[model samples]
Target: MTKKDKYQKVAYYPGCALEGTGHSYNRSTKAVGKALGLDLVEVENWNCCGAMEVKNVDPKLQTYLSSRVMSTAANEMDMDVVMAPCNGCYHNLKKAEYDLKHDPESVEVVSKLSQKAGHKTYEAGQVETIHALDWIKDTVGEEGLKERVKNSLNGIKVANYYGCMYTRPRHIFPEKDQGPGSESTSKPHFMDDLLAAAGAENVEFPLKTACCGGAHTLSDSDTSTKLVLNILKAAKLAGADVIATECPTCHSGLEMHQIRAEKVLGETVDIKILYFTQLLGVALGLKPRKVGVHENVSDSRGFLKERGLA
Candidate 1:
C-alpha cells in the first residue's frame, strides 16, 4: 500500500441517490478516496436532502430534511467539512445552509418543521459543506494523482459534462477556478480537472455544461429525452467514446433513456456514460467492477477492456 501523511477523516454524506440508484458513485468514492490516501468516514444516521424537486414541494420540509443531515454530521461526527458527492445533494444542502443563514424567517420555520419531523435544527455554517471535486483536488494534487495512475486511458476520449447543478446557485465551490480567480464565468469545469488528473483526453463538447433535463425527466420524459439526446449527440459529434458526469441524475437521465435517444437521432451513437468517481478509481488502479462499472446502463467494460486496463 502507498503510504502518505494522514489527514483528518471526512464525514462523507452520500444522499438518497447515492444510497440507492447512485450506489456506484458511493462505492467509487470510497475506493478512489482510499486509493488516493484519504480517509472517508461515513456520517452516522445520515438521511436524504429531499432532492432538488422536493425542495419546491415544501420548503420547510426540505430545509429541515437537509439540516437533519448536517445536524448529524455536526453533533455526531467530528469532521468539519461534510463531503457531499452528489450534485443534487450538494446543491440542496448548500441552499439549505444559505437559507438558514441569510433568511432568519426560513430558519425559524425550518426549526419548527424539524421539531415536527422529530429531527434537530441546525444553524447555517455549522458544518462547512463541500463537493467531492473540491476534496479530490485539494487532498490529492495532480502530481500525486499522476503518480498513482496504474493505466493511462490514452485513446479513450470523454466529453467532460458538468451539467447544470455542478456549477450553479450559491454553493458550487470547486478547488480550482477556470484560470486563477476568474469569476467572470459562474460555470466551471471542476470535473475536467479530475479528468486531466487521470490520463483521458477531455474534448470540449459544445454542450459540455448544458442542462441534461435533470428532474424534468420526472414530469416530462419526452422533453427530457430530447434534451439528453442533444447532449449525447454533441458528445458523439465531438468524437467522444463516453460522456463522463459528476451528477448521478445526469448519468441516469442520459443513459437510462439512451435507447430512445438513439431511436430519435436515427443512428446508434455507441457511447457509454459513467460517473467521475468510477473514472477516478480506474486512474487510481482499482478494477472496473470494484468501481461499479457494471452498474452503468451503457456498458463501458468493452471500452475499458480495449484500453488494456479493465
Candidate 2:
C-alpha cells in the first residue's frame, strides 16, 4: 500500500512524559491527528518504554521494557505499527526491535522477562515502530498539510529542533536517509517541511539536532544549562521568534534552562519555545488553548497573538 495508507491509523504510545510535563505535546498531537482525519489507537495497558534513564542501569532490561510495549501492540492490539511521539520512546522501541533481531543475548533476556512478567515474548519483526514525525510526514505529506492550513502562519519565524534522541547513532533508524521523501538523520526536515506547509518561515537553524543534555539535566545542571542556552541563543541569532520542538525532554529542558540562564548567569534569551504539534494545531485554525499551549512553561500566547495566531 502507499505510505499514507500504511500510517493512516496506528497504535499510539504517548509514554510517561506525555501524561505529565509533556501534556501539551500529547494534546496537540491528538488534536492535529483529529484535524487531519487520522486515527490513533492508544496502546492498552501500556507501560514505560525505559526512556533514557532506565537503560543506564541495564541495557538488556531496557530492551525487555521496550519489548513489553511492542508486544502488547502486536500481540494484544493486533497492530502492525506503533507510533511514539516521544523521541526517547521511539528510540528505545526501535532499539529493542533491532536488538531482538540481531543480538541473541537480548533475545534470551527478553524471553525470560516475558515469561516472568506473564506476557508473550515480543519477537523480532512483530511490529514496526515509528515516530510522530513519520506518522505525519508519511501520511499527510507537505502537500496534504498545505491543503489543510486555515490560518496561515505567514511571516512567523520558526527554528525546528529535533533534539539528539531522534537521530543519533544512525544504525537504529534504518528507514531514515533512504533518499528523497525520506527523513535525513543528519539534517532532518520533517518538522521543517510541515511547518513550512503551514506558511511559517523556517530560519537557518544549525543546531536542529543538538543535545539539550536532557539525560543529565538534573545530574549535571551546569552543563545542561550551558547547552540549552547555546541552542536558545543560536535560534535568536538566526532571527527565529520561536523554537519548534518535537520531543518533550528537549522542550522542557530548553524552557527550564532559558529561565535558569537568566536567573543564574544573567543571560536572557527572548525566544518562545513551542511544540511542533502546537504550531500545526494553530495553523490548522485551532485555538491555542485547544492545543494546551497555555500549559507550556515558556508562555507564547502573547507572541502568537501578536502574529494573529492565537
For this target, which candidate reaches the highest TM-score against the unseen true structure? 2
List per-candidate RMSD values in Å: 3.4, 0.7
CA shift at 206, candidate 2, in angstroms?
0.7
Query: How well does candidate 1 match the true structure in TM-score terms?
Result: 0.90
TM-score of each: 0.90, 0.99
Clashing pairs in 1: none
- Tens digits of per-residue lDDT, candidate 2, 14-114, equal 99999999999999999999999999999999999998878999989999999999999999999999999999999999999999999999999999999
Whole-structure CA lDDT of model 1: 0.78
Residue 97 alpha-carbon offset, candidate 2, angstroms: 0.8
Q: What is the lDDT of candidate 2?
A: 0.95
